[model samples]
Structures are given as C-alpha cells and as structure tokens.
Target: MSDVAGTLPSTRPSFLRLPYLRWGLVAIIQLFLIAIPLADRFDVQRNGQVVPLELVPVDPRDLLRGDYVIINLAINSLSKDLSEGDKIAVGDKIFVGLQAGAGKAAQPVVVSVERDNAGDLAMSGTVRSLTENEIRVDYGIDAFFLPEGEGRIIERLDTSRVLLEIAVTEDGRSLPLTLLVDGKAFQSDAAF
Candidate 1:
C-alpha cells in the first residue's frame, strides 16, 4: 500500500504540467493580436492612393496632451446638392467623391450614401451634422501630432497655406502621411 501511494499517477492535465508551453502559447496569441492592426496600417500605407486636401486650420494646441494640430479639411463642409438628393442624416456613413483640381490637391465633387456611387478617389466620413444648405462630415484623420515645441511654429504660420497629404485606400480607409506648408513639406517628428 505504501509503494502504491508513492507511485500514484499525477492528476494535473498535461498542458497544466508544462507551464512554459502554456505561457508560450499565451505570448504567441498576444503577439498575433498586436500584429493585426499594425499590418493593416502598413497595407494601407503601401497600397493606398495619395490624395492631398487643403487644410482649414483651427487653433491646434492642448496644454495637457502635448503638441498636436487639429486638422480641419476644406471638404468638411459640402453643399447639400453634392449628396445627389440622398438624405444624409447625422451619424450616417457617407462617401465623398473627389476630383483632382488644377493643382495637385483634390476637391470633393459629390457625396453618396452608397460607396459604389462615390467614384474611384472617394473618402469615407461620418456625417456630423446636416442643415438646409450644407452637410458636415468627420473624416477621423482630424489630428496631426507634432514634435515637442513645434506646434508654436505651425500656430503662427498662415494656416490657409497648410495642406494635409493622406493616403486613401479603395475601401475608404485613410491615413495622414505628410504636412505641407506653402507647397513645401513640413518635417514631422513622428517616427511613423
């Protein structure tokens, strides 16, 4: 009986017995989760079409959050007619068609509730407000972070000359890529 007690089979599951294997699986899963979004952003950056939008600069400073510019694009407000008679309500997802202007910058040409109707160079935005004459949309790329102490230089510049260059995928996903002030690239301190 004493020998049998000493040799009793262990009750713990096989996976539980190997702690390192279990932790390694957890670490792999965590790494996989982190890689997904990073890969998506990389894909957009690599494959998306570059579009430059004129900026409607607003006061861009947050005392607590460090230096960053609040980006307001000229396309934020569109003529109601651009909707092509589609009733756009607040909170509705809409696509705005764009046409290249004489300059490199693109201009909004039309708006539609259906992505297919928005043409090739369209951008996706959420309708923020609707009025009798105009529609306002939020494109989510509304903030550009600057290096420490650099916001002051941007704040003093004539914001009308600022342009935000964004890469927009066919599916309407957009990423802000560069800032141009007076037709020249504004060097950003952001690592990526």
Candidate 2:
C-alpha cells in the first residue's frame, strides 16, 4: 500500500456552492410555498367538522411514488336535478352537501354549483370529468399515502366496512383525516 491516503471526490451539488443569503432566500421561498397549502389543511383538521364516508379502495403501486391506495367515496355520485346554472361542468368548482347517514356515516346530500347556495357541511372539489348522467369530481382526498407494506393491507380489505374520515370546513374545503378499516382506524389522527 502507498503512504498517501486516497482522497474521495466531492459529492456536493453546484447549488450548494451558492452564497448563504441566496440559499436562505431560496429556502424561505420554498418553505412558504410548501407551508401555505399544508397550513390550510392543518387548519381544517383543527377546526373542521368530521365526516365519515364509505371507502372503495383501489390498488396502486408505483416505484417512484411508493405505495398508496386510490379511493372512491361512496358519496361520489349525485342524482339530484340541476337547474340552468346549477349544472356542473368540467373544471368547475362545486360544493358537495353532506349529511349524516345511517350509523353516523357521512353521505353526499347534494351538489351545488354555486357557492352561496351551498348548504351547511359542504365539501369542495373540482369537477374532473362530467357527463349529463354524472359529473366526476376530484376531491383532493382521493389518495391515502401509506407506509411501505400498509397499502397492500388496505387494498385487500373488504371495502364495504372501510370508511374514510375526513374533515370539512363550513366554506366547503376538505382534508382527509384517516382510513378506517372495519370500524377501526387504520391510520388516523381522530378517534374512529
């Protein structure tokens, strides 16, 4: 062996070489952007009303995205008659009125295209795909990110007994709180 020690190559990226002030400014901006949405979600969880909706889980596995289950709420479909302006089109912001169903389950009572006309306990989502028969809404709570192997367990669960506990604001914003399996909280911050 030679007397000289082997020097390892530097692994730091070029961005790391920037001045401290520049890096600090970039970090502050990044944190602000990330915190804004999370702050809203957190606020809803703290003050929003809890609504339990039936869950229909679909298996989703991606190498880059890790594990998560795509969910379809039982309250997704609305058969209510819409007036001339009440018709929800694709990309429209709509409020879904919710009411307590059998055994304290939350069910979608109606879909109101207008915000002012939206009743109490309304949840908001953007209409993804719409047809005369049905309007598909993306409620932002569509996926439950799971840790490692947990996704498989949720995927194999009997969907009838599965419930998604969500927090909804009075103004129609919603944040998913937990996934309940067989009336038990699988992953949750709130009681089942």
Candidate 3:
C-alpha cells in the first residue's frame, strides 16, 4: 500500500519474448548457411536422353534413405542406337559414335569397334576431341575392366566403365552424342 503504484507487477512478457528476436536472427543465419552451399549442380545423359539436376554435395539428408546419389537423366539409357548391337560381346572394344542433339552433347550413332589381339574391343576412329557435334569412344567393357560377373552392386567401376559414345537420329538428322548409364537396364522395359 506504501507507494505500490510506483512499483511494476510481473504481468509483462517473459524472458522468452526478449530472446525471440535474437533466436530468430540466429535461425535466419543458420538457414542461410545451410542453403548457400547447397547450390551446386550436375547433369547426366542416358542412351540419348539428357538429365539436368541441382543438388547439394553435402552428406545429404534424404527423405527416406538418408543420403544417396541423385542422378539426373538426359536420355533414355536403354534406347541404344535405336537399332542394333545391344550387347558388348566377348573381347570387343566397342566403338561408339556420339551424335549431337538430345542435350548439349551429341545425338546418337554407332562407330566402328574392333577386337584387339589381346581380345579387347578397340575404337576404330577419333572423336577424342569432342565438341558439340560428335565424340568417338572405345568400349571399356573389356574383361580387364569389368570382368563380367560384377554387374550386381558394381555395374561400373569408373567413368571408363559407364561412359559410352552414342549416335542418335532426330528428325532425319544424325548426330554424335555422349551417353552414360542411368543405371542398369532390364530386358522388356523397352519404352526403348
């Protein structure tokens, strides 16, 4: 009762309110830190298809699996040549010619492949310096690379195992294109 009017009561906001602005600032900073480095990107092609992607190279917090490779597809990897020679036979250094179009790379076509004396498939030409039009490639499917029985958990050992030079036909124009595995292809899934 003695000068109680001069003193304030506890009816005001708590300490939590004061810290809300500071906490919010910290949260904003944290969000920016998390998002900035996530701006990296990549691209891939399958068959003659091109796949574009934007990704973060971090440990990758996934929706279900936690973390994994987000492979983007630029082409249908199963749609090889759109014609023939689907399998890489024994001792064949397959030659693949890339036709330009589907993506920034080539379209799709076949190049000459020869069997080396070591029983390896060797590419017969040169598109070694690839640009927008075409690329020549030697098949790395030789036994020395993949050995055959490793198609399960290891379909590709390195870029040499999966990278193939391909050619494609688009609107009567043939071009050379580079192709890669979108992963392995199963038979009869010929959306081809």
Candidate 4:
C-alpha cells in the first residue's frame, strides 16, 4: 500500500501513532505512581508494631476538602523533661518512647534526639514547637479520611472514647492503621 502522496509508509512501529499503545503507557505510569506508596504502607503494616494512641478528635470536616477527621494525639505535647536534658528545637527530628497504658492506649514515656536512645516502641516525629516546659511534635499521621457523610458520625461521638491505631516501623516511620470509636473499629473510605 502507498500513502496518499504516493510515498511508501515507514516500516518501523511508531508508538505515538498508535493511540492504544500511547494510552497504555500513560496508564502504566500512573499505576506505578499510585502503587509505590501503597506498597510501602503495606510493608509497615505487615512488619511494624501496632501502637494504640488516645486521640483527641478535632474538627472532622473541611467544606472544601471533603470529609475527614483531624486527629490530635494526646501524645502530641510532651513535657520538656521527657527529652532527658537533650536540647530540642523546632524542626528537629525526635523519637518518643511509649509504654502500654492501663488501657489499650500507649502513653509517651520518654523522648530522645537519637533513635538508639529511644525505646522499642518509639515513634518518629518532627518537633513543631518548643516552649520552656513543653515540646510539641507532629507524627504525620494527623488525618483519617472517611466516606462521605461519615465525618459527622465521628464528630458526634464521645471524644474521650476515640483512639488511633498506628503501625510504627523500626526506623520510626508510621502508618495510621485504624480508628477505634468506643473500642470498635471505625472504617475509613480512603484508598491509601
């Protein structure tokens, strides 16, 4: 067969000329971008220790961002003494050691600037602020997205009964695993 201009068509496969092939490549790239983070979280969930934390649920809805619970862990603020004389400043990476409480939740027992000095149940966090008597940290597990219309249910529940289950890796990386409301698992609609 000849081209409209009476020229023979090139024999080499042109990827750009094949719409399916081009779209397939695009789809594969997107899939990989999504899969990588999910796989990392799965690894943490599979091998890390489960640490339960008492959650202080704050505003659960953002009109512009859809439905999700903003989680504030009781352990977010620790006494400066927990650092054991280590100088802590804003933006410093620190590890908070935890011990099982009388209930299912784990309580922060100590804080260290070094991972080696932290306990077996340590969580990695970034120091957000520091005062003369207190240090505030962010664990990066502060939100739990829920299905549409479910944020209200969580907001209405007793805040004292809410708990967050987190999987903490040895390196101090953490993944929010579940939300417990009155000791029952609260399902989330988030895909990752």
Candidate 5:
C-alpha cells in the first residue's frame, strides 16, 4: 500500500505499537481489578473470626436478581443498652457484640458505636434505624446466594432452627460463610 506521498502505510497506534508493552499494561489492569475481591475473600477466610448467628426467614426472591435468601438476622434489633455510650442514630457504624451460646450458637450481647475489646466477639454493621428501646442494624451479610432452584429449599426451611455461619473481622465487618441446619452442614444433606 502507498500513501498520498507514495510512502508505505503506517503500522499501528504509537501507544500500542510494542506488543509486549501493550499486553503488560492490559495484564496489570486485570490484576488490579481481580485483586480487590480476592483480597476481601482471603481476609475473611484467613484471619477473620467466626460467629454463628440465628437465621430468620424472609422472602426468597428478588425481582431484579433471582434465587437468594433475604437474611433477617435475629440480632437486627437489639436493646438500647447495647448501644454503648450515647444514643446512636441512623447511618451510624456500630458493632454487634456477641457471646457464646449453646453449642456453636452466638448470641448478640450488645451493640456499640465504638469498638470494645471486652466483647467476646464483635461484628460491624450500620445502624438502619433506632428507637428509645430498640436499634435496627444492617450487617451487610444480608443475603445468602444459591444456584437456581436451590433458594426454594432455603425459603421452605424453618429459619428458627437454622444457623448462619458468619466470619467477622476485628473491625466488626462480617461475611456469611455457610448455612447449617440442626447442627449439621446443610450442603452435606441430600434433602437440601
């Protein structure tokens, strides 16, 4: 091919002219994006602490998404004494203090806007709403995602007898690790 000056055609854009440089740049970008989620998962799986929470039932479907159990945790509403110091309002970051319950169960003992090392276990959450005697918190571990048709089984489960395995960080944020029914891992059961 020839140009208007009877010269050969140019190669490619100057920025991407070097194959190795172009590929390296793309690889770096991909690694950066992928690392964020991987790090979060690793943090929970490795150093995060585990806390067993009682599960409460709610609708099992979302119109926009599909097949996920809405987690209505038993600890969502707690007593005002758990608020620690002064009264907390909506949108405040709080920690749900827990204590060991009967056999692998964790009970919410208190809720405090500040971190207290005295609590046996603490999971971070945001205050959704509060009242004189009660506080509603959102722990962000509010959904249990499952494969297609699997959520139906969870929805039908008696939540009063179900327990959710949550991994909580020292700072109080938590992630749902598993679902257990009657002290047995739900995944191992054929009925599930």
Candidate 6:
C-alpha cells in the first residue's frame, strides 16, 4: 500500500477483477458459451417460431410472389424420386424423413442431402401459425414473411389458415391435391 509511482489505483477491469463467486460463474459460463451461439445465428429473426402444417394448396396466387404462400409440407415435404434432372434446386436442403415403407401414410420425407444452413430450401415449408392445418402443423406465410419483409408483407391474411393446393409431383413429389378456404371444405378431417 505504498507504491504510488504512476498513481496506479487500478483495482477493477481485469475481467472484473474476479472473485465475486468467480464473477457469477463467469456470467453463467458466458451465457451458454458466448451468448448461445450468438443467439443461434439470429434465429431466423425470431418472432415466435411455429411449425404446424396441412395446407396442401389453395393459394392460386396469393397475389403472386407478393401475397406469397407457395408452400408444401406433409409434415415438411421431401419425396424426391428424381427425374426432371433430379430436382432439388431452389437452394436445396434435402433431408426430410419417411418413404422407405410409408406405412401409416407416413408423410414427412426427405432424409438427407443437406444444403440450407438458412437458405430456406424452397421456403422450407414457411411458418407462423399455431393451430388448424386440420389440427396443428405450421410455418405459415413462410415464417410470417421471413422476419417480416415480403410475402406481400402478408397484408394481414391469416384468415384461419387451411389454404393449400400443392403440387410438385413430377417426381420431386410434394403433391397434395387441395384443401380450399374461401372455396369450401372447412375441415372434414382431410389429411391431404
């Protein structure tokens, strides 16, 4: 306590000079090792990540490319048998499971071909709803216009959801006939 050469009174700021229960266990281990992977790479701009689906098609042209809702999700479709140059493009992230035997109408297939770290694999079955897709299955309006930007800004049209009319079955198989909304069939237990 007698060394005031350069007026050194520095007693805080070297990792908070530690020792307060080891700086609260180093701040909860730096919040799960560096703020949880930087909050999991911005987690798709977060806004309540929902994942319910069952709207095979009914968006004739939800205002086309602007009102957007061109989806495909039999639990998250991926039935590529391949033929038209074995498609899977549009930022491929192919890996949806179920098809080996598809016993109970099995659905949800696309077991592995990885590509979308976030590209969205043909809009990875867009989401943002929590109920009614026959009974829960989502990712609506493409994750609510992906962090909110396009999809015609959604223009507030989540009616009650059930707007499907999917089809990509040239072999990339994502075909789901229809399920209408402003046209009828409010839900007769239609699984596709």
Query: Best TM-score goes to which candidate?
Result: 1
TM-score, cand. 1: 0.85
Error of 3 at 106 (Å): 9.0
Each model's TM-score? 0.85, 0.77, 0.23, 0.80, 0.79, 0.26
lDDT of 3 by residue, 152-182 (tens): 3233234323333322222111122322344
Winner on lDDT between 3 and 5 is: 5
Compared with the true structure, what per-residue lDDT tens digits does model 1 show for residues 1-192? Answer: 368876888898888679898899899999999999888888778888878898866556777777888888999999999999897899999999999665468999999999999999899999999889999999998888877787778788886778888888998888788888887789542225
Off by over 4 Å in 5: 1-20, 62-66, 102-104, 188-192
**Cα lDDT of model 6 by residue, 33-131, tens digit:** 976744533343232221233444323343333333455545543333421123334343343433322112234533334323212222233222222
User: What would you estimate as the lDDT of candidate 5?
Assistant: 0.76
Q: Which residue pairs in candidate 2 have backbone atoms (N, alpha carbon, C) closer than 3 angstroms, thus clashing? A: none
Least lDDT summed over 10 consecutive residues: which range in candidate 6? 127-136
How far out, in Å, is residue 52 in model 2?
Answer: 0.6
lDDT of 2 by residue, 1-192 (tens): 774535755576666657996779899999999989778878888889888888789978777777888878876665545323585677888888778665557867678887667677888888887666777778887787777788888878778878888888888887778888777788864422
> What's the alpha carbon RMSD for model 6?
15.4
Q: What do the candidate models score in CA lDDT, each in turn?
A: 0.84, 0.76, 0.32, 0.85, 0.76, 0.36
- In model 5, state the lDDT of residue 30: 99
Q: Could you give the C-alpha RMSD of every candidate to the true structure, in order shown? A: 2.9, 9.2, 17.2, 4.0, 5.1, 15.4
Best candidate according to lDDT: 4
Higher-lDDT candidate of 1 and 4: 4
- Which pairs, if any, clash in model 1? none
